[model samples]
Target chain A: MLEPGQIADLTEQLDTDDAVAIIEDLEEHEQKAVLAEMEPEERAAVESALTYEEETAGRIMQRDMVAVPEHMNIGDLIDYLRKNDDLPTEFWEIYVVDPAHRPVGTCQLSWILRAARDIAVSDVMKREQTLIPVDMDQEEVALRFQKYNLISAAVVNEDGRLIGMITVDDILHIVEDEASEDVLLLSGAGEGDINEPIRDSYKARVRWLVANLATALVASFVISIFGGAIEQMVALAILMPIVASIGGNAGTQTMAVSVRALAMNELTRSNTRRIIGREFRIALLNGGTIAVLVGIGTALVFSNPMLGGVIAVAMLINIVIAGFAGIFVPVMLDRMDQDPALASSVFVTMITDTMGFLAFLSLAVGSGLVSF
Target chain B: MLEPGQIADLTEQLDTDDAVAIIEDLEEHEQKAVLAEMEPEERAAVESALTYEEETAGRIMQRDMVAVPEHMNIGDLIDYLRKNDDLPTEFWEIYVVDPAHRPVGTCQLSWILRAARDIAVSDVMKREQTLIPVDMDQEEVALRFQKYNLISAAVVNEDGRLIGMITVDDILHIVEDEASEDVLLLSGAGEGDINEPIRDSYKARVRWLVANLATALVASFVISIFGGAIEQMVALAILMPIVASIGGNAGTQTMAVSVRALAMNELTRSNTRRIIGREFRIALLNGGTIAVLVGIGTALVFSNPMLGGVIAVAMLINIVIAGFAGIFVPVMLDRMDQDPALASSVFVTMITDTMGFLAFLSLAVGSGLVSF
Candidate 1:
């Protein structure tokens, strides 16, 4: 993945469909050259695959699969398998099809081998099998595989005819890909692959920074409102970021957990409220602990007991607020039919930062810890 | 996984080895009850397995695999499989063992079914099959399965005797578990399961915040040193967090990419320098774009061109420093044999915050922008 030239080298030697998958990852000009050098049939296969949407099962599935008609007996199936030299190199099961070429059932090799050779293929085949549609998104395909514990599933066209098969190996990659994608998207990094081109990396990352700039101004505007209080006590300026930074971190912790749980199907409508309550209590406990520690450190360093007391209460308040923002932002996004991880950081940080500044400065001014 | 009572109910109906796995996830007291309720032989097996370390193959494998001596012909193997009422309900391959019961090779069911019944198992077996060590870590097992595209692999003891088999279904869970773990750990959140008990969630998340408290003080200490400058020009306080927040975000973006690449085995000794160079150039471009936007925003809002110039310089310097810390911290941790994702946020944020404060304040003081 690091060397483009090496990728081009590897793709040329692989099976045509497999080569197409690798070549699709290359830059456009590199892809053209790789495609042009292929045999016409192979090139046609590759070019047709490129027409499918990115991240669809059509683009990721292997074209090589073993399929036989349902009327064949176990003996005939075995004879055909032995006589054919071009069967797929690896296959755990054979798809049983009808005259119309639609897959009717699947026959695992174990059952076929164990059965008497004279037994009809349809007699031993499993009729209830999962079928993947051609244009199905890869993420949903992975979920179906996970749910059914499928080792291999038949892919069907709109007419319900088998086209290709998706193996467990492909689903493994999709699961990891989707999981890491969520983590990166939450951080506002696009695709976040180390092998990503420099221009693409910059384009993906800088736009998020620009969005952060817009949201950070909201915090700045809040700070500008409290400028008078800050000028009177430089210690407030020193301590303000402590409140915001810790709050931001706490919110991120909650958000990471929430986003992950949603992805795993562990946090759903049936359990969301209960989980939120659990987080709230944990936040209170964490907030109280940090408050006492920060409070003692602040009083000793600044020699101001009242100021320490004010900031301690503010810390507790801000952390609790952070806990709410963390879980709420992602949950709301999910309910709105949006990706739970999309720019969650930007919104959660906005809440925590605003609340942190508001709570600390307002508490100090209200308590007469600082007077202009 | 959500309720102990539900787990107890589910485990009671499963195979003894499977029951043991579910019981092991419970508290010690709960484990005792579950084990006590089991049949004597089942309890003994579960007890022996519990002695092995968590996340090891010993604790997770099914003990009901089909193991046949290498001399058995395909006909006899099929007959033995049919006669055995208690063989594993699901398996893709049959282990071919030597006289001493050590695995010599594997015969995929597909191969056996396709071969003549009179052929010996050894003739049809693949001798180069992957064998998993009994006490191997689950993560290592997953990597092997992924690398070889295995449907199933044999587990062998230290004495080279076959003990059990790990199927692809088990590896699927481990891959998802390990991937989610990295995301959670990077956020300083423990386990991060919504189904995890409230007490457990608190224990995992609070310690990191306390550590954040300690690291955050370093930024505060830096701020206190420049209290005079902040008191003289309060705009410094209003604009300071924008620098730190944006820098922290950029560090997170780069760190997320680097950490994920390392996890995926995409970043390594061969390409580390090239990747670093790529990131450096991207950082410079990102920094320059952000600097221009922030500089213009500050000059217009604050009505102070010199202060704007100072902060723009600080933002650029801090963003570039963030890029270095982002990649360097995780790579160094990887070299030291530590998890690159473990508390990386704490270290990376520490660098960006400290630098954000230092750069903005020192540059202001040096450039006479503060009027102190």
Candidate 2:
């Protein structure tokens, strides 16, 4: 219920982290107001982090950490921890660093709790520890966490000195974000977060729509080239879409598989030929089965056996084309360093829609079922 | 390199666990052959588990676990573990169970390693432990792993008896599989895996193509209703696709967002209206911006201001439709207990393509740019 103005006042009095929590619970207007109220300096830090794509470690990592010199004894470490009133309330391990502030080992909380008070920090600490670079992608970070069964890891700077620490909590966000992003990309949407504003959503989606529009036009233009065929035989128009629709769908299926394979590092140069060959074979099988059904259906609908034969042949051609475009388009896009999921759908649709119309209409005209 | 026949021979000589490992490394043919070679009783046990969908806890759990009586002490446990030669090579915790073999407590390996030999298991075992059900889905299992920061968890049966055990390794596979599945579904494809055989890939893709074909036919039929308009003026046909393509792409973008929101539990009954409104507004804004550009672009390309105006208006209408259909289609599918990712793309494409064609073609006919 807090108004925007009220939230703004709260930020002026509270810290950024505390303000973030408060804003999270408030209405959108209030959150905006509080954000607006912050002085540019205070606002910039939180805003800069907020500017980072959500679900990244930058968004989830805590700025605070406890570091100790490697030379400290257990007694000295205990004194330092006890004296520091602002230590993180919970931590599973404490980092031990060299004089240069680079971590050399880590001591588990349990080990520290159990060790002799007079023991040196180096004596109790385990030296073999995994270190995470600060700029490493969050997904890779999460992978490391999973691989090593880590509770927390040190985030080091370019110089390999500990700058902060990233914990399981940060990884949790990254896992969720990365998972959600894959889902969004596959669907050809911009950052599809529910929290995004209406205007932002509109802006994000419109570009893709425009792209779809261009592709759809290509399909229509292809059909236009055979307009005489459609006018000569209404049946040709009725049957034409069937070819393109089937092809488009088949292409999508292949595109989805290829995009996923590429994302998972499963589809690579070594397997590209194999995957394409597999998709082509699948398209043929599927086309053969569906073409038989659609052909029979078309023959029945039109009461013309010749018409059904033409549509069926067109269906087979379109489906094969769909399958080819589906796998190849995504694979090519991925190879070109574009996002396979983002661009593949548009390109695949263009190929399927345009080819489907051309195949069905051209076949109809060539067969004299529709005379120009 | 291991052939199916050779793997089958190896399975016969190895224990069940070893057989499972060997099968995992074999080619698909080899894996099937080995399973075929097993005795019916042994095969039934393994096959029953294989029947559970891949990535589920049922497929991932180890049938063997070390369950001890609650009465056993540190000295007794140590002696038992030492004498057991066939135990798993790695385990972090030991379960203490009741007479019925239902786990009541767990003790970490490190605790056991450091404890006095004579300490009672009951006194040292942790009473509060998270237990996962055997049938719990893999995604849920990964969530639990992240939430509790678990190293290992026990899998239980319907009656709450310990049936098997799940470790971090199993959860890792689930995380990867679930993530990949979500991505594939969003792109309108069947299960996608790099290791998947080409034949299977073909079968999975062709069905979707056929479905897409059916929908595309519907759109084409709508266009045929206005075929006279296109025949009268080729310009209408040339411009129609531009409008439709933009709309379809826009719709795809919105649809992607909606599907992701639905998947992440971000868009629910509580926020549906808000999200939809937000998306609608965003669509309108995007439509307005793109409308201006496309309108200008068409005008320049065709050298006809009226045609450009028609294209721009169609673009706006089509984009708005795309946005609405994108969110609504997924939401409706989810409500019907269907996976939003699998069928949503097909449905959304239908909406965009149909609306795109209808809007552009109808507008052209209505504007008197083409005579029917």
Candidate 3:
């Protein structure tokens, strides 16, 4: 590891935000030592940034923004900017604040350049600005930027006083990480990344496999209820997995779609019923198609039309039920304020696996193809 | 069902890019009709945007950017900007170009404001830039914006001349969409969205289920090969699915990690072996933990120590094989220029399902726990 002076020397060459990011990742004592080695102004900036928790707007916001009083003219604003050497190297917009430092509006660079020098900043500024709360999660910040097509937004503290601003450049990587997080979490792959430690990977994945064990046990218990039927008609044993496999796949498909929709905020209360209804219609089509294909194949292979009919009806029933469970599980989890992606898949799989077994075995007995 | 004139009016009230997006979503004839009703200049702009394929840099790039000759001074640039009435309402940077209109550097709005009037454009501009090709895919553009931490980048044609510019604000949505696309595709859920047409959803999901049907048959065939032993002992049928279930879950967890890594360009040829080794160790830990739990449970439930031992060995072997298949399938698919997310799951599931059944049932017979 580099010494404190060496680290401080390296960080001093970077932007204050970038410098803070590096020091924040260090151990507490090491960070303190590095901060002590820094210049007072830069040290104070880094320390202020560290006051906020990771992945929050306060942590990513730049303190180097320019905020002018709403009464200032474009000429004064331009003069202030040209005279200040401490300002950030790149900024697309400036906030117009009242006497209390509360942001009243935002003025774009082009608007400033186009307006007459004598025009008040308030006259050129747009009042409909998106303000990010200082402690907002970075993912929420990314969403706001995307939704409003923002170039830069002011970050306000609890009292609604403008503190700093976050630029779109700072948000690009956060969007990618958050979206990828949903995919990894949905698959029961906790925070999946190539650079993740092996022990961490084992811990994350084994916990999921162990959770799946309970679901597997539920499926086994369902199968054991019909163990006598399997003994009497061994062919049932050979073909039973096919129903569960297909049902699980179908459930996963719907669950993936629903989870993605939920993440993007596209599936909301107003459209919940409509989306569910749409999924059901899709389920009917998919179940019908698979039932026909499997039914014909089973009848020809086993030379037993009755058994084929039993499996066909079961396959369709399981698939449609799987679809309902898929949508319901994620939406329910989301409403409960749980991350739908994190836990939805395990529940959806459990439902499909249990239903897949119960539906097929019960149908086999009901149709007189086997006995309990 | 709005008329062409009404549609044109609605689109006219929006930004040019927004207008083009609305027009692009319409059927070709409807789009043409709407375009015909628009003012000639706006219609021409929309038509030019339509020449590029959907989801390309050309479609997303703004043609309204300002480019200036490198020798121009800051004072002249400001005068020209103030004189031009047709400039975009908002722009973060202006490209400094050569006589042939190829970008030599990029001048930020802040740089111009801070520089003295006599400072040449090239003196203040930063030469390092990320220039996007007009035909580059939108996802790739998003990646470049993210990698470079760019606020905006010039879009160049095949001739390496600046055509338009893509801003990070435009890229924010693409990052979310592309990342979400990876998750949806990996689950065999094609473009999964709640608002997607019912017919399209049905078509996408049913095709995946049918593909899964083929994989189900392979599992069923493996079970069929063990039919004699299952007939001799009903316990094999009751426990066989547990092996496949746990193995499949483990495989999916690994596959998700690998696919995300491959997508992010983190797991390249330079680090493939290291990641594979990392996954292998994780698999061992997972397999060992699961084996002990299942082995003891089976032994206590069935009162057969040898059966427990056979299952324990089989489970470990199957889980390890699953880990290999999970990484190899996606890596191999990615190397073939096919989307690893699209087909890796199907192939990995097929392998784990077959191996899970084969290893467990084969061990049962080899250990003389059941007769063929």
Candidate 4:
């Protein structure tokens, strides 16, 4: 084998997956050279999986298993087992297949070890078995594993033939990836992977920032229409952002809930109306509580009761719009086959900010509370 | 044996674990009653797991297994398995264990079927086998299963005694649950299970809204100070919100990234500096671009190039602050052992809004851009 230093040198030149693959193809000397070359973190990740395939059954399954076949004498089975290797390694059951490499049934290792071995494999194997399709999406695969509480199941291909098997380990990665993806999408950040190149990260984040700017411009244009009112009443300028800020926050909270529900398959056609109704009620309750507090505070700060009333009314109206827009925006996007989370925050912010300004300024102008 | 209908009924009233336990306890009629009461969903969940314990090996494992003792004549082993009634229906290997129920070795089904049964178990059973601890966290459990590519594994208690077994199915659920939990926590939402009660939904959402309200008030208070500037120049009021909205959105984008990174264990002390540096660079690039567009728009709308220049500088400064606060606030909170995701959003919003208003308003006053 190559010396440790040589291995470390080689490992530094390759990514973890490639290094592992190359090592597998090399002689013991070369393998050692590459492994020793790897950093501790890379080595650990690679060495931990050296025995399994890069993408196949062996790599994804535990080596611990209990196996037996169609025929055995109970006494002979026990005596043979007692005098031999230990029992109950990593295994859920024993497989019984036909002579041509086709699985017919299975028996639990517990049942076999606890029972007399005189029984034939056919006698113990359960006739009914749920076979997994190997190429299934990992999320769907995990779902099956969850629903079934399967310890280990047979993996089969399109021909109804057993191929290599997928175990719980492979599905775990799928679950984590899918969940993280949803979160990143919700924020309009492209798949937020730390390992992603700097260029990719820049490209993803900049586009969203630009979009937000565009929406902010729309809000600014709306504010321009109210320039006269603000010039007349200084308080209007100071208090206006409060309305937008409260509305934007309320919208974000509601949007978060809706997006999560949609992802979990919880908010569907049947429940949409009910969920919306519930959110509305909650919004009113939330708005009223905050309106009282902020209203009183505004009155005290500005010493203008009428100004406080206007702010209070604006807060209530904005919160209501926030709740509605939060659910409706995502749902509409989903219906259009767009990712519900994609650019949703931008749209929601636009609605809340625009409405916050329009309502507060309009109310001020309409009431003649501040004369231009 | 219980009828399918009865088994279905019983499963409806119990959680998967409880149902399995009662299945072991029920009289034939009662078992049938419980199964009959189960709806399709409940029945499917329980029936699929009839062989395993709730959390133990039995609940999560398939009952199919293969086994042979150490002493069996190879020929006799073959013959005996062909006639057995209690053997597992199917399995990948046969376990060889001691009288004390400790596993020592294994034999693959392929080797057994191909080899002469006259060979002794000692000659064929593999000595290397990985043992699994039963009480391991599901994520850890899934990792082991993936690392090992295990089809079936024996589950053991603290004493190293085999308690039950685990399979890919159980690990699948663990993976999904862990992933979903991270996603929900990032959004400050409770486990967003649809089945969760409405009251819980209410409690989970209201606190964040209130926190957001408090932050919104800070922004409002900032505006109040700029009342004189607004009273002098209507354009200042018109443009102030644009600055705040852009900064808020940019800050949110960065906050989402930081929170997600922290949750995934990707952003640790070692990488914190690198991550922060990257976000700051992106913020500057984004801030520059948005400033140019907004500045031009402001100049055109207000018919004053000087006003546009002042606001543009303010926009650039506020956005950079937003980015800094976004990454730093979460990192600091995480160090203090508070949930970074839960409170970061509110804090970031406050920073962006307050800074946006302050920067824009102060710049206008200092630059003499507003004429009373």
Candidate 5:
């Protein structure tokens, strides 16, 4: 609720990095006004941060960091730290750099605190560390932070020189965003922000619904081909949707699992085939159980065992196809460098719907339960 | 990939908290074996961590952390830290404890480093901090950490005495697991772990498919009630899946948004009505867009404007109902203290499918496009 001047004053008291987090979320004109209202030094840091593409390491990282040379002892480091009033307002680790300014090691604050005054920085610091590239996507950066359990890591530019640091707090937001983002994207609810303007929400959602409508047309086309059979036997129409519904549900289940696994990098090149086999077997068990329950129910309701058999077989076939389509579509999209969650649902549904209808009706016609 | 003995040896060099992570996942017998092989002190710490319920703050927390009294001067605290060789291996902040060992404030290492030797700990410490309950669910803990941007937090027992510490690295796994978990649960794919046993996978997936089969019966029963109309005008059958499919898609989109929003605490009682209204408007726009596309396409393809009009109106009505169901079902489930993501999809799809058929067929008969 504060005005731009108040925000600017607040930014002056905060670190440049924390200040950028606030200003970067504002509209471009608003950001400009806030920058104009801020102190020049803080304004310069905000401006430089704004130059990076949205959701990059550079954008989320704090430019102010403590990077010391490898030769500094604990006593000298503490002396230097106490002497400097202009250091980063928040930093948990120190980057130990070589002469050319590239990081050679990282020293946790605890390690420095626990060490003797005469110990060399190189001797005490961990040689192995995760270094985030400046232009790396924030999602990837978050994954690295999670994987390595990093509270803070050195952000290196193209030349491998330390430029800034990214902390755990920064990655926390992106983790929630990226994780929730998949659910939103998979469901075709773009951004899924409740605060989003109705126009924006409407635009993104309607586009997805329309794309879905086009695919539903493919299912419609399959049904239309069996119009003569449907007219002769109304039961086909009554039972066909069940097959499609079951298939759609099965496909979605598999697709959700595949999409998440791919996101986590658990379904990788080495084990894709194994995972595919695993999905196939799960589908078989699921398809069998549904076929039994649905087959008996349809048979008793219609007093026709042949009709029951056909629908049951169709359910089995369609669900198995759904399982394959679910894993394949997302894996294919991911291999093509696309977001598997974004378009996998639409494609999987189309395949399941089309196959579900085609299998049920075609079996009915071929079995002479309904003739064209 | 290493054997249990090698892992045991490797864990010997790691912190007890890290060692527990390795041992906690092993078979019970294997965990016992690994614990038996560890040094008595490390084993005691690891065994104590294992005593808490899995996925609680205590289970993930490390027993080692540095806490100092509030009145301690920076110079004295530094001397104490130098004298004490045993401290948490990885920690970013120091908790300032009261006389009774309850946390009163927190001091970051950076703050400690920048201050003069004469300053009291109270002067440099941050008074406001996020404290975690020892027995609190890990997921809730993760949410709190993400919300507050905490790298480390004090875990206090029921008496508000500091018991342990939770670090960011511990939370990262939970965050990823939780986010991926929603996707799996919503789709009725239990656990969804690629490495899960095939028998377990089959048991979980088949149960869901069978439940879906039972719901599909409700849709089938609805379609059966309108069999005569569908038989008289077979085009109705061809076009019905399109309406139902679109409704299902719309419902899913809304449900995903609402479920995720609810999970993130974005949709509270205060904003529930606003979000509901927002979704209603979105459904209107999405439904209208599909009605237009489907209507025009149906009229051109079938040469029946009345039939097209019927289908279009049906799409709009059914989708709007779907939108309502989508938001209401999850919101209600959440209010009742259920995991909305677990069962919302099934209920939403059931409503959409049954209503899609009832709306389309009822409209066709009501408008005299077909006769019962």
Candidate 6:
């Protein structure tokens, strides 16, 4: 989108990999033109990074890190750091590297500051450290960082030599992005970026709507079978949506909770039975509360006690079913190595809507509340 | 509920405030009994923290931090840290304080380790360090930390003297909590925790269902008005729910996007018009696609071209309205200082359901498509 000179000027202000990303977005000929204007060293680093797959640790790590010889004394380490102006300006820990360049240990700044002047780096440094594999998925890397509460971790190549470092600042963005991704995907709302291109947004969203149209047909087929009961009593038509909509809302509530629990790893096989029992009990409580209110209200509005009783039973049955379907569907999806939140709402709604219609209409017909 | 001895044993492993929180959850008499058993120093610190409201920075910050006088040289600071066995075991930076004990600057360990022993601490310390107010809400503190990419920040009292510190580890919990809160609140799904007590879960979820029921009544009233049309043609009853449910799903998709954009600060007044226009265009495309698919399928199933045509036009109209209500309602809520995600689903469904019914049934009645 820009002239070669403009790209060169802009890329100069960005990190090497970031600059390479912008250039790569342009035509192949323009990419070469932009790279040609960069310093040879900068060009090489960017080109090397461009070879890594996107969203991997290799693609995101900063190439600069403070790695010092393992044999240096505290005083000599300080002197070396002071004299090396090319070293990174900001770092939390100094990596202690062996002769072959693999990280042997790490010395946090706190340890260095607290060590005696004559103490050897080997003695002061902590021998244990979490190392990030160069080709690891960014999400897995983030999970490791979170598990260890890491401020920064060294990234090593397949051969185990230190290549770069990944900091908490970058992981912060990844965590936020991943968390929001699940929430958006639940609603079939693609990435949900307002600034995304119209074409990209349509491409992401239209297919989901099409999928929804398919699921909604399931509910419609159920409704079509209940046409006789609905035609016999116009009141059934008035009340059908209320039952289905309420059931859908209840299902969404339980689904939201179950999805979050699964994501947090709080609900596992060890606790699944207990959690299901808990939801079942909660559903009964919720079901009982809603049934009484709707039953009493319907009776007053329609002046038919049997009609009210039929609806109350239908409401109870649908709500309990909603609770079960909400947790069961997501758990089943998760067991199959699928993301529990993805299209969960669509499936949950399908079950609730179908069950809501089937229960209410079947009860009405059987009880002769609305004779067909 | 535990014996005083068990409480004392348990408290030993927890941070002072966390121990106090557990004690405070007990009855007043038991709280006093537990606090009395704590060491005097621990009790004093816990009592001071208890004075701050829950979920404030003061309640969360660690009391231990590395604070040094600004006049010290790098060698002197290093010696002090080495000599002080009572100082915190983990620290990222040393706060350089003035005579009044107010933080004047911060010296990161990396900078200190890289500096000459003869250099004054102030010479190497960063003066523009982030300082958090003690009473700031944890959420606001989290936002500040995220915006600045801070690993740790000093917490200052009202007098601007350093009191405690908050680390990125704690902020991780806050960020995750806030993100999940929005997702759960949007669904009106209480704190959907698998471990939440049945009573607590029931209390949280039922109120939302009750609110939804009230909204569902509006749709019911609308359907009640179209009773005559539905009785004359059973097809109207079968088809009505399809229109409303699809429209509701469409509204949810748009609402989810707008709410997330608002949470991320991606959609603001400056970009509101552009974003709204983008959603509007996407809606037309989505509406057109859905209308065609549903129209073709319905016409073939019912063998009534006019009936399909009526439903198609209704689908188009309702979907466009869903797009508007989804973004419009959330935006207005945000403008009025309400959380855009809270209760947004309820209001959006109400609008979509009403419009879907109004457009389809009104058309059916006027067109005499169901006048058998």
* Cα lDDT, all candidates: 0.86, 0.72, 0.88, 0.69, 0.88, 0.84
Interface RMSD, one decimal, each candidate:
1.7, 5.6, 1.1, 5.8, 1.1, 1.7
lDDT of 1 by residue, A1-372 (tens): 345555655665565457766878778987887767666766776787788788887887767788999899988998898788776677888999999889999988877766777999999999998999989988788888887878889988899988888888878877878888887898888999887788999999999999898889999888888899999898999998999999998999999999998887778899888988988998999899899999998999889988889889989999999899989999999999788998789999999998999899989889987664
Q: For model 4, report DockQ.
A: 0.29
Candidate 5: which stretches are off by over 4 Å? A1-40, B1-53
Query: What TM-score goes with each of the models?
Result: 0.88, 0.69, 0.95, 0.69, 0.94, 0.89
Give the per-residue Cα lDDT of candidate 5 at A338.
Answer: 93
Error of 5 at B241 (Å): 1.1
Candidate 3, DockQ score (0 to 1): 0.81
Query: Which pairs clash (backbone N, Cα, C closer than 3 Å) in model 3?
Result: none
B1-372: candidate 6 lDDT, tens digit per residue:
478767876876676545755765678787777778877877777778878888789887878888889889988887888898877667888899998889999877888877777899999988998999999888778778778888889999999999988887677767777778877988898787777678888999999999999999999899888888888888888888888988998898889889888877778899889888888998899899899998888899999988898899899999899899989999999999898988899999999888898899998877878652
Q: In order, what are the TM-scores of chain A for the candidates?
A: 0.85, 0.75, 0.93, 0.68, 0.93, 0.86
> Where does candidate 1 chain A have its weakest 10-residue lDDT segment?
A1-10
Query: How do these models rank on DockQ, best leading?
Result: 3, 5, 6, 1, 2, 4
Cα error of candidate 1 at position B187, Å? 1.5
iRMS, model 1 (angstroms): 1.7
- Model 6 per-residue lDDT tens digits across residues A96-116: 999999999988888877777
Highest TM-score: give the candidate number.
Answer: 3
Fnat: each model in turn: 0.76, 0.51, 0.88, 0.54, 0.85, 0.80
DockQ of each: 0.65, 0.30, 0.81, 0.29, 0.78, 0.67
Cα lDDT over the full model 4: 0.69
lDDT of 2 at B97: 92
Q: Please provide, for model 2 over A121-145, each residue's C-alpha lDDT reduced to its tens digit, 9 standing for 90 to 100.
A: 8998889998887566676677788
- Candidate 1 per-residue lDDT, tens place, B1-372, comes to 345555656665665457767788788987887666666766676787787788898887777788999889988998887677777667899999999999999988878767777999999999998998889988788878878889999989999999888888778878888888888998888899887788888888889999898888999999999999998889999999999999999999999998988887788988999888888898899999999999988888889888889989999999999999889999999999888999689999999999999999999999997644
Span of ten consecutive residues with least summed lDDT in model 2 chain A: A14-23
Is candidate 5 or 6 superior in DockQ?
5
Root-mean-square deviation of every model = 3.8, 7.5, 2.2, 9.7, 2.6, 3.4
